[model samples]
Target chain A: MGRTLTEKVLGRKAGKDVRAGEVVSVSPDYVLSHDNSAAIIKEFRKLGVGRVRAPEKIVIVLDHIVPAADEKYAQNHKSIREFVAEQGIPNFFDINAGVCHQVLPEQGFALPGLVIVGSDSHTPSYGALGAFAAGIGRTETACVWATGEIWLRVPETMRIDLGGRFRAGVFAKDLSLKLIGDRGAEMANYKAVEFAGPAAGELDIGSRLTLANMSAEMGAKNGYFAPDEKAFEWLEGRARRPFAAVASDPDASYESVLACDLDTLEPQVACPHTVDNVKPVAAVAGKPVHQVLIGTCTNGRLEDLEAAARILRGRKVHPSVRVLVVPASWQVYREALASGALAALVEAGCVILNSGCGPCLGAHEGLLAAGEVCVSTSNRNFRGRMGHRDSEIYLVSPATAAATAATGKLTDPREFS
Target chain B: MSRGAVWKYGDDVNTDVIFPGRYTYQIMAPEEMARHALEDLDPAFAKGVKPGDVVVAGKNFGCGSSREQAAACLKAAGVQAVVAKSFARIYFRNAINLGLAVLQSEEAAGALDTGDAVDLDLARGEIRSAKGTFRFLPLPASVLGIIEAGGLIEYTKKRLEREQE
Candidate 1:
């Protein structure tokens, strides 16, 4: 009768023992929103609250359509700035900060043993740090801002145990794509997924974030890895506050358990229109691509940039393909610059955009045209996601994206390495 | 009883198609968003849908992204409710928070077809059509309370007023 990590976390927040299917009201340590803050502001106004209950608990980052794509967006940004200043909300990142998912962890807000909610579905990306983070709607977020409380149903836990080591040219993105493909997009709907086992432990923080970030694609309420030495080491200097890690009990109950062996895993790609329409890179190799995007909250970390750089060093991109490199945050951008990864990418004819979510959600920067195909390191391949409805997106790892950009087609990363 | 014509779709009808991400930042007004609802998935949906029409789809309806516009647009466009085999977690919450009725019934999703006339009884959790009738689990009282109040904003306002009283 042991409790899972989710049960333990919710129990602490609820001030009582809770079980799956039970709804409890609790105040989250942080509630995040980005460009959608404009809409949230509207909803908050409708609530007629003079001021937010707890401004410190709210985090706003402007990365969706950074620097204002047009007059309308600029007005929205202006309103947000005014609202942030008036409400005395301390945590606010403007256009230069980068994607909210990366900026939250980089600023040390995503701590273990805390509850966090955001207005974006990928808000669960923070669960990689062992926090119980889930995505909520803008209206719910506005309510949280007004009252400082929100209700959540304790979710059933799904345990995914990853074993064995990944071969060269295969990465966390490949494993993530494989899992979604095998289980389909709705595999973990409304459930919490805990990644465990040897391979999960061996993955670096960046890889863990990639897995947790893509968990949204599987419709998971949240996805997380137990905080271990690696997680603690990553948070050592970055974490703003001290936190105690949470872990599941030895006999914690799980709705189901899935065992994934990484030994034979290969580079994988999600084809046009859906994230779960995945195949081995070899199966779809030689499909012509017009663009290659190598950054976003999904694969826009320093390690991902270095992975692409290793492949693109001293090599020019295919003349027909336009390669765009975006860092996840200013911190990652600076680190890549210092490490010469940016130089390698730039020298290889890649367009290095600023640190933000560039073209991942099709808000701005690097949108595809009709009949164009893009090999992207970012997550989500839904139709009309990046640009024209006729344009297609192929989701791949950074190594695979780089290889595809170099060849102007969907090429396996193994060919480059 | 609430009745509407069904607009049928298949599995994984994601938010990107329901309300394209390209308009996520550009459009703010709910009415404006209504113009783009399902424009990518089905161009005729926005123009043809009446105020009481319902959307029927297979598994994972409203999947992808946490944009409330996906539900808000449909609601603005006069979508009475959405019937699906299942729903993505965040979108389910978004739909309720926006006061949009969302029902999950494998029976209803499989039985309903495009252009079918259907009637829904919220009080009894029954969906009746010419083909037959399907029952879905009744929503929890707490969720019903939110919808009854029109949305979370009104619910919160009432709660705040009660606290002050």
Candidate 2:
């Protein structure tokens, strides 16, 4: 019997053969935490561990509420700094680095064939690099820090084979929304999803990140793409250490297989209140939007900005709309600026915020008021996610967000194309 | 055995609604968080919930962000156990690590309604109510050990002490 990527990775780490549903304790290659490190520190202290078991394996990034949104957040950051210094942890990215998901990969910490766990649910984003990445609770993270190992249940694998090219203006975000819509939020619960097939090769690293990041929305433990030439090329200069990429055997068993054709896929939008509440761009067309945000761990890369800039170049944003562009990391920000994407967006009346998680998680920056509607490229349109409980958020692609910003309503990106 | 009144909810009751994201960065005690538990979903949940009350919900309960506050707030708000048809993966671990009981049984989730009285027997993996008796697979032994030890913190402490000895 052949082994799936997840079983292979976990089995290697465990120093023995493993299978789905078997719990094994193994030390992970990397463990990430963000602003939640403040809370995690408290839990760590309770373990009475004077020093972290493996400081090198820990990565901390402070970007959830950058520059300290208020006194409370400021104090949290202060404690985290003191903890980092006291513990002598070397891999700490201060406020300016950007979101943890993007920063981890950009800093060369995410590598293939490694088991990575983090405090944030989107830690699966690293799976785009062919790593076995999963999210765990803060207490579990603290325990890992204390013991240098954690238990994991090898998840059943779900194979999603993507074939055919996407239509113009329809990208990976659309495909992601479509998948989540067809399979409800709990469709992949306790499972690992592997993205494969012909069309998977066409997606760039940024698009792969979007798909892997949104895998959390479908209750997946992790999502991954096999490391191909593009992945190896992208990691050549960024990987901190040499890694042996892992892949599923040709005949590996899967809990289920879903085949998706991207040729006819249209722009998709996750309606307000639920990520699975999805509809085609045309279904919700003409709904007025108060704000249009294009950024987050899901879609805040340079390519995302360029896609938005393509639609908004030389065009003014609607008078009733406010467009905010947040690059995923400082590196992406510099690249986008050099590529003229930032210039085009700014010239079109879009506001370029610093490279941080601007308004994706609603910690600060661009909060919405009651009765307001926002069209955002970020994932999760849950009620009160970006501000007022009554405010609405429609999740769309960067191009769709830009198109909506131009018209101050829910508009399809294909219309502009 | 444990017993409580039921506070029922529908499918996909995400962590964002259990504890709003706006308070993610705010440093507050667990008790204070209990005040805002489910404020957006049901304003009465915080004020009316009594100690030992249980939360029953449809599929995909506690879905969304991996913020531990979602599980913390429910534990702080005096929820004895959560019975749902299913739970998001991360939240299930958080609940168990916090020493909160979580039982999965579609039969109980469908039969229980708001205000229904119920008894949970963790040892027998059964939920008894006026509707009837529903059986759920008990948590694995390793997981049940953590809950019995009053969460991961205490469990880790004991392990460290044993190692040092």
User: For this target, which candidate reaches the highest DockQ against the unseen true structure?
Assistant: 1
Question: Can you list the residue pairs that collide in candidate 1?
Answer: none
Deviation of model 2 at A366, angstroms: 1.1
- By lDDT, the best candidate is 1
Docking class of 1: high
Residue A323, model 1: lDDT of 98
* lDDT per residue as tens, model 1, B102-139: 99999999989999999988888899999999998778
Error of 1 at A18 (Å): 1.3
Task: For residues A1-417, write the lDDT of model 1, one tens digit per residue.
Answer: 998888989899999988888999999999999988998898899987799999999999999988798999999999999999999999999999999999999999999998999998998888898999999998899999999999999999999999999999999999999999999999999999999998888999999999999999999999999988898889988999888789898899999999999999999999988999999999999999899999999999999999999999999999999999999999999999999999999999999998888889998898889999999999999899999999999999999999998899899999987
DockQ of each: 0.89, 0.88
Per-candidate TM-score against the hidden true structure: 0.99, 0.99
- iRMS, all models: 0.9, 0.8
